[model samples]
Target: MLGLLTSIMRVFEIPMAFLQRILGIKHLAWVFLAPNLILFFLFAFLPVFLNVVYALTGGDQILLRDRAFVGADNFAVLASCDNYLDPNTCQKDLFWRAVHNTGWFIVLQVGFMIGFSLLTALVLNRDIRARGFFRSVFFFPVLLSPVVVALIWKWILQRHGLMNAGLDAIGLEPVLWMLEREWTFFWSVFLSIWAHMGFYTLILLAGLQAIPRDVYEAALMDAATPFRTFYRITLPLLMPTMLVVMVLALIKGVQTFDEVYAFSGGGPGSATTLLIQYVYETGFAGAPRLFGLASAASIMLALVLVVLTGLQLWATRKNADG
Candidate 1:
């Protein structure tokens, strides 16, 4: 066994040493990075570049060669509106409606997600009974696949599902969770938060635990109230983690699709139709595929995401350094 292992090592080691010598030690790092860089270029950078190319053209044609350059007409049409706030006034009303819904969705989702995640983290951080069990229970949702998460919530929220059954059992009126527009949108946000808040709570939990025990001890010694201690010591110390959480949550909120799509079907008169769903429906799902228009909308979405991505990267890097 020892001889065979040595033979195998020798068979593979010689070329690595030769390449290392040729590349030099410092430059050799790029050798290992080459595969990842190539994959990223092919899958990430290439797709983005192709999206830009597609956005500049117009046609139902899916092939790059067949698309005739329209040079921002899709964008122009999207922007053509008597009132920016009213989707009905826009040339591409669905795009605007999705944009409007996405704007509100992101604001509410990120704010409430952070608030709820922080609260969950705080509760989980306490030295209470079944703390570990509670932490696991809260975080379990985060591990479920997005489609699975959506389906679970869908079954729960359906008129004949667990939620309405509970309501009936409790002598309350059964409300339409997915049929009404407003209620559908409400579930979109609520389901999104329920699926994702656990991961953010874990982030905040680590932040909470990293605080110096003596700081809280001193606060207790000075007879600081719970709120005062949280406000004065805990919050200030947790700001770094909070910043990362907010940026990440914002990005996730913007990119939301699968769960909400499966949950609401982007229905109830397009009430829950998000920007991502718009892009998907335009490019592929809908008939006479508006590939160019979809590409344009996607580019716009990507631009916003690019900015948020930079912020998240900065926050994460800063957090690691601190």
Candidate 2:
């Protein structure tokens, strides 16, 4: 292994030396970066281009060559709503329903998720016993596969699962968790927050630690109340990181699928069906899959993310300027 490694290095050494002479040291960074840039272009940018292409064309065909260019009919179909507030009034009622569900999910999940994450981060930041253990315990869920996390929660929340079993053991009536509209939606948001809060909490923890100790010392010296210090100092200083978390949480909320789909299967009556699942089922899961429509839906989702990112970036920039 050592000899082969040495031989390969020897082979590359000549060209590197030759290139160094031709390009100079300054340009060598680009030479080193070329492979990664090429791979990123091919794997990342190219697929995005293809997705846009697919969205413009129409067909049930898998291949771009087989699909026919249909302009904006797919967008038209989705946008053909009599009343934006009423999904049933729209031509694509399911799409609107998914959008409605996602809006509510974002409001509940992101708000509670951020609130809990910040609280956890604040507690972890304090000088408390076994702090490291507590931090690790909180973050452990983030290391698990989303599928695994969902499956674990599913086992806990199902009608005949651990939760119901425990209830029965306690002489309490077992409720249908997944079978009801309210409970399923509640769990979906709760489960999403539970699964992902640690990652954001970790970010907020880093931000919290990065705050200069001198500032807090100064606040203490001034006899500032804890709430006043937090409101006036901690919040302003932490706004940047908090904004970043908001962007991520919003994007995650919008594009959420896979684990959510597996957990609820959009079940009972599409109660938990989200936009991403709608796109997936439309594009891949059903017969005569409407690839163009799915692509359009995805592009709209991308636009939403772009808007969200821009809004936060503006907020970040404005905060810095102020």
Candidate 3:
């Protein structure tokens, strides 16, 4: 009876009391929400606004008052290129190279990432030997710190590292994995997939498990082949989860930085330098830091992410309608 009274009070008495107050119940929800709203305004939106301000201004000063307003000159400088095909012809070769590398990275990484994750999830979802152990084994990499993962791979891939030592034992040539442009890019993609595939696999595995066993049983009773059943029933049911995984993987691939930076340091002539790395280098890594250009690049990256998000939403709506 006491608990019931407390619930009743919560639902009616408190609300009615609030309504009777001069600072009324109409604004009470905002009163409760104001703390979080203020924090978001201060921490999230404020920095973005500052970044836009910085992008529109020029000169070496970090202070807003000291900076000169240069409009879109920074953007124009980024756009100044004889041919977009060749970074060599561009005024900002490094930025273009970073863009090119990031584009290829996202394409290759997201594609292989989806394929490998789906394969792992499918295998693990089945009745197999040491299934629990295998799932844990795959997921262990995802649990490790990104810095730790990068360092481990770096040690293995270095010139005088374990990989080279093993190659020598097998009478194979010591591959300079990080010293070449192609190898650096290849390793970046490879490392990213290896480290992150487990998370996507877990997502897919959950989706797979959520599927009713009766569906598969029905398909079997119908004398349906595994492939056909998977195509007709499983694929259709899994599309929603797959879409979520794809969008998440896409965003993660775009935001990739820590692993690539820690692993390769964007080495071998900017081969693996991503947009985030380029922004960091332009703004902080070098002397005479170009904050305006970095801000412009940051804005460009934001636009790419916005487009990707918009596409995901559209795809989701289409799938829902279908």
Q: RMSDs, each prediction?
A: 2.0, 2.5, 3.8
Cα lDDT of model 3 by residue, 191-257, tens digit: 9999999999999999899899999999999999989998999889888889878988898999999
CA shift of 158, model 2, Å: 0.9
Model 2 regions lying over 4 Å from their true place = 1-6, 16-30, 312-322
TM per model?
A: 0.93, 0.91, 0.91
Top candidate, metric TM-score: 1
lDDT of each: 0.94, 0.92, 0.91
lDDT of 1 by residue, 131-227 (tens): 9999999999989999998899889989899999999999999999999999999989998999999999999999999999999999999999999
Q: How close is candidate 2 to the true structure, as a TM-score?
A: 0.91
Off by over 4 Å in 3: 1-20, 314-322
Better of 1 and 2 by lDDT: 1
Number of the predicted model whose lDDT against the real structure is largest: 1
lDDT of 2 at 210: 87
Question: Which pairs of residues collide in candidate 3?
Answer: none
Where is model 2 poorest over a 10-residue stretch in terms of lDDT? 313-322
User: Cα deviation in Å at residue 278, candidate 1?
Assistant: 0.4
Error of 1 at 145 (Å): 1.6
Per-residue lDDT of model 2, residues 1-322, tens digit only: 9999999999999999999999999999999899999999999999889988999899899898899999998999999999999999999999999999989999999999999999999999999999999999889888888899889989999989999999999999998999999899999998889989999999999989989999999999999999999998998888888988988899889888877888999876878999999999999997789999999999999899999989778877875785
